[model samples]
Target chain A: MISNRLFIRLLAFAALVAVIAAIFWSQNPAFLSGGNIRALMRHMSVQGLAALGLTFVIVVRHFDLSFPGVASMGAMTLGWLIASGAPFPAAIAGALAVGLVFGLVNGIAVARFGLPDIVTTIATGGLAVGFSYFYSNGTSISQNFFMSGILDLNDKRIIGLDMPFAILMAAAGVAAVVLHASRVGAGMYATGQNRVSARFAGIATRRLIVLAFALCGTMACLAITLLVASSGAANVTAGGQLLMPAFAAVYLGAALFGRPSVGATLAGTLMMSTMLNGFTLLAIPYYYSDAIVSTVLIAAIAIFDPRLSGLLNFRKAAA
Target chain B: MSALTADIPQRRRGADFLMRYAFFILVAVVFVAFAILRPTFVTPGNIHGMLMSASIAGLMFLGLTWLIAAGEIDVSFMSVAALANMVTAALVQDGQGWALASLGGLGAGVAFGLVNASLVAGLRLPALVITIATGALAASIAAAIGLGTSIALNNTGFVGQVLGLRVGVLPLIAVIVAGLYAVSWFVQERLTFGHYIYAMEQNRAAVVEAGVPVNRMLFMLFVLSGVVSSLAGVLLAANLSSGQPYLGTSYFLDGLTAVLLGGMALKLGKPNVLGTLAATIFLIGLLNGAALLGWTDSQRQIVRGSLLLVGVGLVVFARSRRKT
Candidate 1:
């Protein structure tokens, strides 16, 4: 039954995307050019990776406000290490480690100590950003860093797709399989749906939550690596702007899928990236685009809940 | 059974006492530590600065206490304040009187508050999500209305001179903060509205079933929050002598920190105005002390962030322990 609904939604979304694409193409032929398409894909891939991690946390009915902090810290860590003559692999490993530790702290605070997820993540995120700023001395790192490997990886295309795009797609495929086909995935969904029943049914709900957070942290690290490599520098505010779009994508995915899923999230991410690219081509200011996206997100959430829609009707009737 | 019941009440009373006085004790400790570490911390000038800092945050905290007690949250108050400040400053820059311009700013805040109230109360959407959208929207509107980034206020105006006024050794803003706190205390502790707020937080269904207009009350509370926060923004602009688009960005976090650090429970509807005031003062003192000790802004932020985490953790832990 869920799959049937999912299939219908996916088809509808695809149709909508095509219509939007046509509109953009009419406005500017360059919107569909090969170079522009590749650039759009790269942008979508960066956002998708973060949204993918967020998908894991949100599926379990939790919010992780720490992703921006984690990404910035990871990027700064990598940049600082590479600038200090550290090996590329070592820098990557260090960044990953930082992400894992931060994720673990958040998971423990929420799952074990029963702290509110949003509050805990917000605090941890602030700490993470602070550390990044302190480490970078409040300046963007633009020193000589080992970029040959990253540049080469990005350049390596397969079947006319950027390497980063391929990696993101592969990640989404694996996530879909795990979520739809694996036992642990079932446990996670059950935990989110009803904790008491899941516990009664012998699921280690706390452990599942912790694992979800860990995966989220690791994914953030990978996303930041791509960002730093592509930009060849790390700024104190580097991952701060990704939070809103990532969140909108995650919720939109849930609205479409009737639940959170990586595939749905990737679709949502692509739609957003495409819309943003089109908006840019049309010379619309960034703020207007943000306002529109947030409105859509709120509307999507409202539409997904039958109760909320019913309440809206009742309000109208009263008025 | 009788003995167990008696013992439970006694234990609960003891816990309540500790919760009430914990913040005060923490404030004293912070004061002493700073005094010992930094020779200039106890000076009259630094003390005045700390009080002045507390006034703005304290006013916002007053509004937050009411909303949190009613089981709602508004993260957009800061944005509303920023928008209000910009409006007031822009009007003043256009040669309008300070009284009319400040009123205009407050009106803008009330307008935004109504939008929030309609969405949150009428539509039943989560307060957090709706407020986040409104906040972003408010910021965009502020930027669009020619308030681009920052604008210098006309310092020769009444708004500027009044905010800068001091009563001998005390700032006028501090007196306003004190007056606001007294009114809030009266509203929370003396009025039937306060009773309704607590009742709603404890059990919304019960309050609604008991003939209370829950939605209307919530709408009013949000408007009150908006008005107070905007007033803070106005005073902030007057103090800085410039209107900044991002001035209120840090207030949301700082307000939350003060509220939680003041021993307000996240799960319970307990309002602690005194504790909140003390927490604000403690936070300012800590920041001033850090400056005196020659710590960088990054280091101070790290300390503040960690303190927020620990403070919230302690409150949550205490609440859970009491439940057990």
Candidate 2:
């Protein structure tokens, strides 16, 4: 029962992915080899986890620029704790707690104090990076910390799938169910669509915004855990680089699905990961890859958002 | 009812006075505090150095005020400035004349600014998102232009002399910044365009109804911002005699902090040029004081970040309180 627009968008995205894959395969014969496919899946899952959280925030019409900061904070906290001989479970819990606190800070500043979400989150992100640097003493966390049970979790693959990918799938499934089948999700949509009307209808719009940010924070923590396991060390810049790609993926998903949906986000994340992988295989410079991805992001917004087109037409008529 | 209205204006006047002077008073107090804490802080030489640093940020801050006043934000200016700096430095390194190289850099800025304006004003996309993407794109392009991290400028020419110019202990860059501020003040306070900007801030619909060229104004504002940012970048390269690709990164956050801390309310959408200047000076002083205290770079960042949050929070809370 898919609408024509949705079907076409999906078909277009699929064909685009197919073309990119074929191009990469031609460039490198091992591009789609089983080994490379698994690696790409793992990379996408790690990135997809962060994008999923960001999708919730973006759906509420707020930008959580601090998510990368929260991720870095979580990673640094966990790495420092484990290096300092804390139990693995305690370290994980501590990192999640840090994420929760920062998320709450962002939520309160934006939802309660009425500060602009982007500006507030950007400041908080700086604070989080500061905290990460302070905690790590401006150096990467010791690699000895990676020898713990957390690293084992990364390798606990099922069949040919990575454990992180499995976890990402489960999380995505849960998020899809929560967003599409729950009353709260409906409230979230209502709040995002029209805050004043949602409030008039007795929806706690502020609470929903705060809840979305909190969920984003928790997801950042989860993503950091996998990131630390994969990288085997926590650096101050670990999470900052993830923000651009994560944001691009979320917006790309919103464009494809005609809404901010978890499934669309996963698809966008996988597409982005594949493109990045292809770029690497083709030996494209990092800056060019970034420029290309960002251009794609702008293109997605322009092409998919009908309101933007309407605005363009309005401007033309007025002129 | 007459008496009630009379009392309302009086109360509003009181609040307005407080809003306008609070940050200025804070700047004076902080300056005095720092001077008292470190005698060297009050020295003319140190103060000159601080003002020289503030000049670069102040130039960017000037443009930001206009952009924010138009109810739009351009985070891309910093990257534009950086890219412009790189272009100028690369050209100078290749034995091109400094004036021609500087023009090339400014041209780059105008070009990027036009792109930004098209997306933001023509396409009517969210300024925040558009500017962020443009900033990233500009920075990547700057990096891709064969400037390996930094480019050293040939500084034996007129450009270098202008950069190193001084009147007594005062740097010429500070004089240029002061001139720019005066021009900004004149524009914001006296010009008909300034009136349009204020009107647009108060009510876009009303401004449109009044037949103001809103989109064109925005387009011009961004172009002016781009040009000024390019000027700042050129000066920055001359001052350092090198162009660093990541030069303007810190200024992005610092410029925002300066604007917000200077009492420019996000809700009110009013630009306070003088307040922004004061905030820039105060930030420079704070950094000077931090250096005197021997704080690490991380500590300085932490302080700046916290100060920005508090400043923004206070403004938002104050606005909400006034509403209630």
Candidate 3:
């Protein structure tokens, strides 16, 4: 069974890589082109920024459904600040502050009220979207000269890859070190594994949960910046479509990286994005594209926990 | 002795009746407030429209209440409903009779529900996760086979008319919904399965110790939910005269809101079917009234989502209080 699990993940990875290679070969005939790889990496970086925060939330067994709302709020607020003649650094800081407040509200709701994660987040998500819509007045934010400097992060490459790609890699590294190499990360895992036990162990489970939300909100804030720089527009619906892909990445990370690891989440984001990019390049039908993602998600669930596949003879609750 | 016994039963009956009906009174108060705000809101025709609007979805909630009360979720119902609609539509298009279409839709619903139950019961997977995955899978499969477009029923014939007709100014769907509530109430309050479902919900380990096939009971609950949901979908297809993949999304919030709002406490073991039916009407009334008051679509979504949040909060609070 262990071998079977490994083989399936390996197949998933191999398939992802093969699809990318095929797309590259068909489009440019220069499969190893530096510019193309850099471009892909640049896109991956923006997606990674948001996916990283989502990883923190999901690993702790709570989903941040309000992520898109937070992201849109941050992005539009940043654009508004920049448009009002703020410096780049100040605009970014202001955006992060907005995210922080939203995160705090979510933390208070979940920790103090003991609300169900799904209920609280779904409500907060709509609230955030509503706030964003009201704030933006149902229009996309305009680009500014200051925003142009932020966009340059995608254009500059170190050696053959873009700086944004490197930044994404560095962010993943930090997440890994914090989660696996630190006490706080252990506390998060403890809290998620069993709240009652974690509280008994003096883990300050509530605070750690709050910290997880803050991290998620911060990451989403940063991702909004990157998204704005890349797409040059901050519409209300900009962050909505990313939810599915973000969720897909987290689940894929669990399947690929040995359960909810930050590194796994990062890898999953890249893999999912690459799949979409390659499929589009290959001229696959839209419905088929959806089919592929759904199939992979289910396959991952079945493979990651074989007993959960319902193939065993006893047919009893084992997991 | 006969007089004393009669008094005792009368007192208990009064309390039970109040416990069952207090929530409906609360709804009536809200309805009065809305009617006062908008004079036309309480009109007979508008009230009938509201009942028709909620009937199909309210019926689905009747089934879902049992599954949720069993401490398991079946989010796959909407997707299964979509599949059932598409299959029935396809059958009808292929020159099959209406009865066959309805049967096909219901049978497929049960089969899919069985699949969901098997996943949750046999595999020990989390019900929420399993249902979500399978739901998406089912939806994708349906879309793939749906001829790459939405299907509209052009010919009514006898089957369509019977399913679609109104009975004494009330939609047939509304009658079916009332019938479903009665059946669900009987099964939950009077049947043996109801006892087992409650036992499992309260303490599954104890139920297993008693050598009851807990998995089978839970599985059957999901199957029941699926079959009922498909029936709802067929009724919907007749009413709307079309089938589309995206049509089921709204029902997710609708059914969830009704079940939660109708005093269906999590700790109560099984949900109140009659209460759920009333709550369904409440929601329908609120939406229709909001529309008449000139609220925009986005405002409607915001209202619905917020109302659901409040309902969930109430349930959580009630459950905690009962514990105290």
- Tens digits of per-residue lDDT for model 1 on B51-113? 887888787677777787687888788888888878887888888888888898889888988
> Docking quality tier of candidate 1?
medium
User: On a 0 to 100 scale, what is the lDDT of residue B124 in model 1?
Assistant: 75
Query: Number of clashes in every candidate structure?
Result: 0, 0, 0
lDDT tens per residue, model 3, B1-324? 567536555665465455445556767887888888898997877877687778877866766888766767777788887877777776677787778887887887888888787777766666765676677766766676574576777764565686557889787868877886898778876897777776777799999999999988887788888888888777666666766656666676667667655744322224567667777887787788788888754576577567556656655554564454
User: Best TM-score goes to which candidate?
Assistant: 2
Model 2, residue A37: displacement in angstroms?
1.9
Instruction: Give the per-residue lDDT of model 1 (tens digit) for A101-176.
Output: 8889899888999887866787888888889986768798867654435454466788777988987888888888
Listed in order, each prediction's TM-score against the native is 0.90, 0.93, 0.83
Model 2 off-target regions past 4 Å? Answer: A307-319, B1-6, B9-16, B154-156, B264-269
Q: For candidate 3, write residues A165-234 as lDDT tens digits.
A: 7778888889889888998899889888998999999989888888788888888887777777677666
Query: Given the true complex, what DockQ would model 1 score?
Result: 0.53
User: How far is A83's C-alpha from truth in model 2 (Å)?
Assistant: 1.1
- The local distance difference test score of model 2 is 0.82
Model 1 root mean square deviation, Cα atoms? 3.5
Better of 1 and 3 by TM-score: 1
- Report clash pairs, candidate 3: none
